[model samples]
Target: MQQKGGAAPSLFRNGFLQTILLSNVLLQIGIWVRNFAILLYVSETTAKDPYAISLISVAEFAPIFVFSFIGGTFADRWRPKRTMVWCDLLSAVSVFAVLLTIHFGSWHFVYLVTFISAILSQFSQPSGMRLFKRHVPEEQLQQGMALFQSMMAIFMVLGPMLGTFVYSTFGLETSIAVMGVVFLLSALVLVRLPKDEQEPRTEEGKGQFRREFVEGFRYVWHSPVLRMLGAAFILAGLAVGVAQALGLFVVTERLGKTEEFLQYMLMVNGAAMLIGGGIVAVFAKRVAPQILLAIGMVVGAVCTILVGYSTSVPVTLVVQFVNGLVFPCIHIGISTMILQWSHASIVGRVNGVLNPMFVGMMVVSMSLAGPLKDAFSLVSIYVGSGLLFLFGALMMIPIMGHKAPEKAQAAAPAPAAVRTEP
Candidate 1:
């Protein structure tokens, strides 16, 4: 593991990093605006029906389950710059199509737009990961991941607020147009990325999508660290999924709070994540990633349990904040581990395989959360989830005792391999 001094490291010295961050910030803003606008549009247009609102979530998430692995496969083969740019361009076009559909007097196209954007995002995300792996130095990978996540944390807090403001003040059409324009701008900015420096593909690599896809799975299965990581993520997802599924009920029925209070709690958590991401970015290199991850999981598990048992609103909010703060530790640890352990050749596919384990499991856990709450109680669900988190934390202990696999060490590229043009 690489350690830096206490002062903040200068990751921004690289022009490529600056360009990607600027474009990503703009793209995130547009996405958040579009997301909130569509959400509000669905709520208002459907008379606040729960089913209609749920459809938006389904539309947004289903593609991840269906296409993430495929996206990862293609991400490995394709130039990251071109793939990301085209995905953003296509997303912009999709948003414009949604605008056109609305103008033609049909509201149903909103879900289609959401679904299409999500599908494009599946492609863009893996390619972005590949780019990050290629450009960031090994020593600063954790910090890079933390900084990226911090950006996401900032957006999570502000995006919805901005989206709501834009929708309410300017109206849906204008909001959608703004979203399209931002995406287009993001694409244009991406054109500034230095050309990809990937190894040339062999003739055998030209047309073997199925074989390549299967190989990704095989690689993950062969890697002990990745195998365990997948398992941990699945359990973490279950824990989180149950909490999310029942959070509103816990607020209303248990804490005697309104929806507004729930919103505040979420906002507070988002703000905490922003703080936590900065902390990790500065200090992550000092600690072993596995140890940090274990600590994060254990703390997060305890917080989850406390949130279940705590009756006071203030107490729960504090717990939620702590939860937010610690959760990023696990995320940063895992992301850095991926960068460290996996060869660049397969990192995209590794991400593709690993992402679904967490997301798909979350979906499954969510499906079970309702019935579990109805049959048992909300507290019971929380306890179960906390226990699941504990299990994941415990699983990390064995890995903590060992050094990274020899193959992993051997596979790591030199810093120059990832350094980009000034």
Candidate 2:
């Protein structure tokens, strides 16, 4: 139900909210253990061969670009609660399959664990979003998103440590076993979510993948908000890719510090993200999403330039900290905007369409960052990324002050519905 300038509902009181949050915690534990254990194992086996290590990343991320839309399409067709549960169960099964493969001495097949789990997540994550739409009250959506992102930020701080400790203390076999167990536990937790509403099956729904896929694109294209969001996603993706690719250089060249200092920077950022999520939650109702997103992008742009230009370690760290503080604004704003703008039936497809645009650009920019670095100064590249962020913020201006449509308006025909203003 929509709130009209009243207090929001108690988010924790919702059964779906409680269940999904618990499920996410378990998923994070599994994911981190999987990430670091596989990394350490690959490092040891390949004798730290950079190419071999890079393949792990390829296995993990390649599916998001290749299978995100496909997974999303299926997510729309399937029951969300069942889809999430099955994804986790299948992930657990895949992890154990890889564990057996490892035991049999075909250790290289370990990459299969990461690839399969990653692909399943493409399906699972969108379903989670669908569930969010189903269960979360409109009034509490931002706060709910904040709580969700804060949980992730906590993992950002602790996940690496937990993963490394599990791998180091228990060894590869136990680590993989732990990953399987946590995934199973996550699946169990998701069973507590509200049952999916049953929709009547129609013959028309059976063989319309190609048409539905096209409709997703047309849906986004017809919406002014989504079109601008897609543009912003492209810019943010490029900016983030540049930062991810050259972040080590900020420690090494800009601050003249060793690579170990990078960890401290990450910790600082993660901690700030936790606090930022809280603050955004408190103020979520007071500010519009477009404004929140624009504010974050503007801060991000400034911090990127500052971090790039700062020679002092303290200056760089402060910039990172501040950048982290506003990062959730970007995420929460984007997510809430999508939920508010899109209808429930097409939420998965919308996510699938938008996700690839971001991931695809990030991959492209990461690939380009190397050549760009060779051609230009690091500071200049950073400034260019900062400009990209600014452009992303600019894309939000037209949609500023926009609010979600009423339920009646939302239920109207797609073209007429999306084009309606608050």
Candidate 3:
């Protein structure tokens, strides 16, 4: 869909958006069911063995680190629509395979359901980004990202409930079956996406995979905007990781509430996210992504400090709500900026290179947060996290006036996408 004159294309009318959003909804249903069902089943079957429980988490997350770049490289080389469809189909096939294995007294094999899907998603997610870059008008990128994030926010509030209800009411076998079915449906929904444009072939195929992967890094390093964003990603990851690790402490030690109260805080945050997403989507065209990102980080810094320092329940909750509200800005702005700054052909690789920066640093900081907590006061840790947020905001300053660069020619290398000015 193309923009007419200066008017943005109708997002709801766009076939890509319609299909992808519906596919994502089905995907979310399957994912949450798989997540909660597996967790509960593993807990009961293993008698809540700590190692077994930890292994479940490892199965879900480890693949992101291992296969992200590899998957991204393939996504760039492959047709995005086909890649996404195959990933979902494979995920469904794996889930059903796990279900069958469970029936034969091999219940421990259930971890493969999470592991395989997680690995496939590394391939699938980047392909979706590639499709997004190819299909979405640059003017509507932020709005589209906001809308997508808002749907995820809705899931954050409802997903656990839905998963728990299904597992509790229907048992493990049925939950697994449901997950398989949902994934199948998501694959079907994706069939409605517009056909992928055929690229002209030359005697030489898309460059060597290894060479392209290395170029992804070089691409980010050379772009002043992307370079700053990478640094921001690291700082933001560190800040978020520490805050996430210590959030329970804020609920208990600071607010003098039990651990269960954390759910209520999450609920408030989720509700605020829905509202924030709406606000951002409405005003998307008015603000540049860098400014939006910087503002979000600054607000996050203030809220982080307040949440740590507040002793009153209402005050802490309010700060938590505000934090939830602006959280979408951070995500939407980042996604929009990446799409705007990178060439369409290299979107997958750029996402692959950047996502790991955030997730890897977050994981490292999360591990360190425990040790830091042992040595420092909770308030002090919160203040430090806030400082990290401030630093992340400062990283945006260099790119504040930048606009989306002109789309590079399909044959251009990654670095050719870089534009020195707005």
Candidate 4:
């Protein structure tokens, strides 16, 4: 399981890895372009109506809640490469359908398109996770995941700007067409990936869909480390919910800043994430995943508290940037742990179960955040979020003392099972 001679493998040198990364970059760009274009289009058409904007968020969230687990079950049962390619092709078709609706002046169909695409993405995500688990070497798993995360970080910074520019220059119809093309390109590139070697199914896994779904839940519930991780994820979701609900008010009402300043704060944080991802890609192997999680949580809690207390724009920006910097560490640590601990056969369902826990909690937290904000001062909400983060960090402490199971280590899939480009 160790690296060959303990030297880091060159990720770019692996043709399969290169194909995945390139395809992912294009896919991400298309997603961001579509997201921002739709948001801007909605805002302008609806006169900045809050309800309309909320509908877009709901469209994105509801699919994850409803279809993620189902998607995971299918991903496990299906071929990973085929699942991913078909998902991409379906997404492109959805975009084209949206374009046709737009041509017919049925703008309401846009929401339906978004929902369908989100549903397809649920399938694609777990398929991608399964691919990473099968293909990436055990010792270099963290590095591979970190590099993938860094691409996301870069896209977060660039996507919105690019979306806005394209929308402004070409209008909605043209922008939608571009998104369709980008998705098709992503599918074509994914076709270059070799077919996955299918593993034999066990008797326990052969059954009704309901049983398979419940099995995923049971597996995670039985694993002590996974149980703790799920608790931390819920708490982290609550913290995020609090921040999302009250962040604007804290900036404008409490600190007397403008929307422009808020945008600057976001850009700074995005840039910090890009830099932090680079650090993780280079040094993630040297640190234990549990230790990395603890450090990220502690640092995030402190910075979040500082952000609440600071009145000066410069001070708030600095703390927010630092918060973003450590954020990737938390993600990389958790993802690597999931890949290492879960059996390849059920990894898709495991991811599906875990993702909804975080998102569902965020939905619950968002519901509560509004009432809590109306009752207490915004600073109070921020401080409460910091406490929640601290609680999550405390939950990680026990994990630091524990070790991965020897059986899990022995069960790790061989690299030969993962086919790369010849």
Question: Top TM-score: which candidate number?
Answer: 2
lDDT of 1 by residue, 304-400 (tens): 8888888899899999899889878988988887777777767778899999898888988988987898799777778888999899988787677
Against the reference, the lDDT scores of all candidates come to: 0.83, 0.87, 0.86, 0.81
What would the per-residue lDDT of candidate 4 be over residues 1-422, giving only the tens digit for each residue?
A: 22344655676676677889989998888878788888889999899999998898899899999999999888877889999999999999989988898889778776876788899999998988888877677677788888887888888788879989989998878877887898899999999887777566555445456776777788788777777888888998888887876778768976798765676777788888889989988998798777778788889889878887888877888898898898888899889878777777678888999998888888888878879978987778788899988999899887787665433434343222221222
Q: Quote the positional error of residue 330 for candidate 1 in Å.
A: 1.7
What is the overall TM-score of model 2 with all chains considered together? 0.95
Better of 1 and 4 by lDDT: 1
lDDT of 3 by residue, 173-287 (tens): 9998998998999999998888877654333444567777887888888788889999999999999989997899988899889998998998899989988999999999888
Which digits, one per residue and each the tens of the lDDT, describe model 2 over residues 283-313? Answer: 9978888888999999999999898899998
Per model, how many backbone clashes are there? 0, 0, 0, 0
Once fitted onto the true fold, the runs of candidate 4 whose alpha carbons sit more than 4 angstroms away are 1-8, 202-204, 405-422
Is 2 or 4 the stronger prediction by TM-score?
Answer: 2
Tell me the lDDT of model 1 at 253: 82
* Per-candidate TM-score against the hidden true structure: 0.93, 0.95, 0.94, 0.93
